[model samples]
Target: MAKSKFLAAASHDLRQPMQSLFFVFTALERHVGTDAGQALLERLGQGLGALKDLLDSLLDVSKLDAGAIVPELADVPIGPLIDETAACFAPAAAAKGLRLLRDAACDVAVRSDRTLLGRIIRNLMENAIRYTEAGEVRIRCRPAADGVRVEIADTGIGIPPEHLDRIWEEFHQIGNQERDRSQGLGLGLAIVQRLSRLLGHPVEVHSVPGTGSVFSILLPAASRPLGAETRRTGPAADRAGDASGLGRVALAIDDDAIVLMGLRSMLEDRGYEVLAASSGDEAIAALERSGLTPDIVVTDYRLRNGQVGTDCLLRIQEFLGRKVPGVVLTGETGQDIVSEIVALGFGAAHKPITGAEMRAAIERQMARHAGASASPVPEESRVAEPA
Candidate 1:
């Protein structure tokens, strides 16, 4: 508990600056046209990506330790998942002159949490690409008796037999003795192991030292027939191109001035009319004074004076006398907090959220609000706040 609390606090503090940097860089990228500027931006983006990975790894370990992650299982199509995961790592593989191949010929559905499953596969692929100096990384799916086995094979530096069992231990990196940040913090496999156990999936590894490695995850097959056409959805970044929150008013609440500024700048860049405040009361007061109804609310999870983002959202909605779509931005990785946010039916975007992610969440919430408005009673109207 102590460790979790410390990590949560540290993550929240660290992410504030990171989040601000992301917004600033994104804003800069828009005006940067020269090759030198583009190159510099790419390097900065890579640095930010590394920082995000480290922070994410720490939070993930904490969440697993606290048993914060609850898998939402469903009949997830295999082909689309494989396709999407492969596409995500295509750029990295291409950068290394490696091919990312996906053999999704098996038209099967897996009974697992799609998000968690994707995390596992993505980690494996990243690990594969990171370790492999040459050759290709291939993802192949095959039918098993109880379910399907998805194997991530790579022609990289394989793990030794003696070290295989210990690789899943937190901070255990094979061949990275110098503790190089570029090699990753060695938390990927640990997260994969915990998530797999949580989802009741069996994870297997086969490797020949100095040759290659294959990580396989056995996921139970869904008790449903395969559909002729599988719905394909890309990452939020990819889907955000057409979704704009332009001309929509957004209210942001956060105690941190830097975070509030970043949110304001980023939202404004995306054409959103933004109003920012430091607390729930302030946000409500602003709304009451201006008589402005916000189409969407964005807030930090933890606020001043023992308040929280959810309360701010609810207060704003109550003041507006209507349901408003909300996005809860936070660095907190506690299961209880995340559960509460989800229970409130609000969208969640973790701290240090990329421009694309923030945009996607805003767009998603706007769509939801539009749908709710079309209904007889708005969804938020039915949401009963706790006494």
Candidate 2:
């Protein structure tokens, strides 16, 4: 517990500067136009991306160890969730010249936390794709007596029988004795084990030395029908290109000046009219001075003077005399914080957000509230999962 808490606090602090670095990178990406400069920038982006991935994994491990994540069980439709997750990895799989396939998932509903389950599937898919050199990665879903069984199979290097048990241990990887970061930090399966245990899902693995491997998880089937509000919510990478916030007004709130400046620059670069503020009062004043209502509200979860992003969003809505699409950004992994952000109909994303992530979050909220005349808060909102 002590170690977990310490890591969590340290990771939270690290995310601040990490976010600033991402902002700086975003601002810099627009200026380098030459092929050589772009190549260097791409290399730099890869390094930064690797760093971000490591930090995110470490944060997940610490949060899970500290029991900071709570599963919000729901009747999540397996088909859409699987399809959406698979789509996100399509680009990566294609880059490796591997075929990614999903068997026609039946209209099966699972009784589990949707977000956690998606994470489990994503981690397994990523592992399969990373370890595989050629052939294909396939996903299948079918009805089982125990529950709905979802399996991901890969034509990659298989695990040895003796080492199967140790794969769930942290930093355990086969064939990669050099500890290659490209092979991943070996925390994906560890996270999968912890999440499966928390959700009471049974995970099974089968493999042969050089042929391939299969990973499966059995989720308890939901007896009730799917609710009207139940739907897939995640980063639409395919649609991100069209999610430009052009000609729209965006209000960005954060206490950190560097983050605020970087964010403003990034958004302005994306062709949005941005109003940046360091606090609730400043935000309100800025909005009032602009004499233009904002199309979206983006704010950090924690602010100076003991304020929270949720309260600030509400205050803005009250001041505007209507509910506006909002997104809450934070590095905190506590369930209570995430729950509050979602329950209030605000989109949520972890801190150190990239320009793509921020834009996706904004696009999602705006689409959700589009064409409504000051619609009340929706019943459920899914936070943006890690890319």
Compose the digit string of candidate 2's lDDT tens values, residues 1-387.
787788788888888899988888888888889999999988988888888887888899998998888888988888888898789999999999999999985576889998899999999999999989899999999889967999999999899999999999988999789988988998899999999998999999999989999999999988686565555553442243247778888899999898888888888887889999999889889989988789889899999988888888887776776789899989996878988899888989897777778778777888887788975433232122113
lDDT of each: 0.82, 0.86
- Model 1 lDDT per residue over 263-290, tens place: 7887888787888899887887788777
Candidate 2 ranges with C-alpha deviation above 4 Å: 104-107, 224-242, 374-387
How big is the positional error of residue 49 in model 2, measured in Å on the Cα after superposition? Answer: 1.4
Each model's TM-score, in the order given?
A: 0.87, 0.86
Q: Which ten residues in a row have the lowest lDDT in candidate 1?
A: 233-242
* lDDT at residue 181 of model 1 (Cα atoms): 90
